[model samples]
Target: MLAIPVLAAVITIAWAADADIYLESIDKKFFNSLNKIESIFKTWFPKFSFSTEYHIENYQINSLNNESYGLLYSGGLDSLSSYIKHKKETLSLISIWGADIPLNKTKFWDKVKYKVTQLAEMDDIKCYFIKTNVREMMNENLLNKTYLEGEDTNWWLSVSHGLILTSLTSLLPIKTLIMPSSMDENEKVPHGSDLFKFMDYRWADSSLIYDCNLSRHEKIKYLLRGNTQYYQFLRVCYTQFQDYNCGMCEKCLRTITGLLIEGIDPNKCNFKVKNGFLDLIKYYLSNNIILLHSEIAAWEDIQNNIPEESSIEFSFGLKNLILMIIIIKRTIKKEYF
Candidate 1:
């Protein structure tokens, strides 16, 4: 039996659920391949270096033989895109709480669970909900600290999220785990990308990273081809976890921007984008909060896709300059005070 131990939510969830994990038939060659791939990905990021102190604990390996398979669905664009692509297949949809969504807040989680379950049932897919306290165990400030101080962009998810997802398969009854790609092949990074997904799932019978072929904007375009009804069910906002979208947060605004660029009405899809939306985009740029790299790329695509004569025009010129001056003044005042 072989197992690679890591700190992950899946381990905690399995312990909480008393999940039986079997590893006697584990493929040693596949496990080594996963480790080697992980090492190669580590080399991509200058700040990241693979730690060699981790060990395989005997207790972490239990026994299970169920052939169930599914994905870690969050009702977001990437996962939803993958869901639509594989809707016809017999698969289970697993949702985890205590990661992005708080574990104890029943008001928000209950609503999300209900909505997700309905979405699954509509497609005749089995839905499983797992609640965990893994986030509570770690210090958020420390977790947010970049691998190399002042050098690397904060990759909070990349550092440990792949292990968490991979661990879920080993601990649960899931044999095959399909994770949606967060970025396209062009902007490949070490964290949460297809490279990480391919390297992390050594224990599963089949572990695949889906949709590396499409960019974030392209995924939205593909998703729009499907029944647009699922658009209303998207829970992209992390600011207000209880609500579907707050419309003001960076995430909500980014999604709204993409949807609008794709000629889709955000309001019709249940996302309300108020007036002065361009000003908001400027504020984001001034604050250095550009959401995701793909988002920036998507914005450029939006500009290119729309005809120049179209009434809906987007420009990031004067507003951003004015906002930057205001922000600089505010920062100087706070520093002096």
Candidate 2:
């Protein structure tokens, strides 16, 4: 591992000495070192301006100002909605292969590419779909090996995407990265040390991005105000491939369930899916998945009831207990079981 200091920020890079290293390069240690580096930089450079952009390489980056912004695109409803709603501003869309929801037995690549092109045309904006050698980078960074050794592929994928996005930002002029947030985390959910620890490890890791800035209400407002058709096109399921969503999968369940509580019919979505989706509502209510944050918020909205103090504390206690159980199980199993 080579530690390179840039502007007082210590950047650590793990080099592959052997044939090829995958996922293993980005381990807990690497992320920890990254946090240390970011801490140092924040102390020194209190205020910094950066821009975001996407391109095949780092071409034409110099033409952009330091304040210009860019966003990650997956041709999903979130990205599409944001693009259409923020059309007045010049935004660049960055894309990577295999980072989106998995669509089975479908030519989703073509559909996604078409969607990007169509969005660019309709919005009269410039969209850049840059393909990163993610697999290769992971191999070089040895993150692939780490992921293979680790059981949490979903978590690793988020880390991989974060590293790639951060690297892209370094190559561009952007200093801040925007991500979607849920109202549960921001308003209703009770404050707990465990919750903060989880978020700090996942979303607050600076190695994943320069400065990750998530806007919960802003994203909701954007979706509410933007093109309704565009919002309807957001795809949440990754396990199905039939042009529309499966609606039964975890992602679909979360999205549809949230929309249901928000008084929106899932059927109105461009993506078609199974009907008995409501059956899974109970399951979602029971499961402790992260996406449930939005679902809970939607539920509160539907009931038109503010979360009582006891209800908030109960939710937090439940989440914390779930986390503790998970940790205990993983420790006993010696894996992310």
Pick by TM-score: which candidate is best? Answer: 1
Instruction: Give lDDT tens digits, candidate 2, residues 130-247.
Output: 4443343334235434322222222233223444443443444442343322334334322211122233322122222222132323343345433455655566566755565776
Instruction: Please give the lDDT score at residue 91 for candidate 1.
Output: 75
**Candidate 2 Cα RMSD after full superposition onto the native fold (Å):** 12.9
C-alpha lDDT of residue 285 in model 2? 43
Model 2: worst 10 consecutive residues (lDDT sum): 1-10
Q: For residues 160-261, could you state the per-residue lDDT of candidate 1 as single tens digits?
A: 565555554555666666777655443433454445535444552445544455666677777653467787677778887656778887768767766765
Candidate 1: deviation at residue 68, Å?
4.7
**Candidate 2 CA-lDDT value:** 0.40
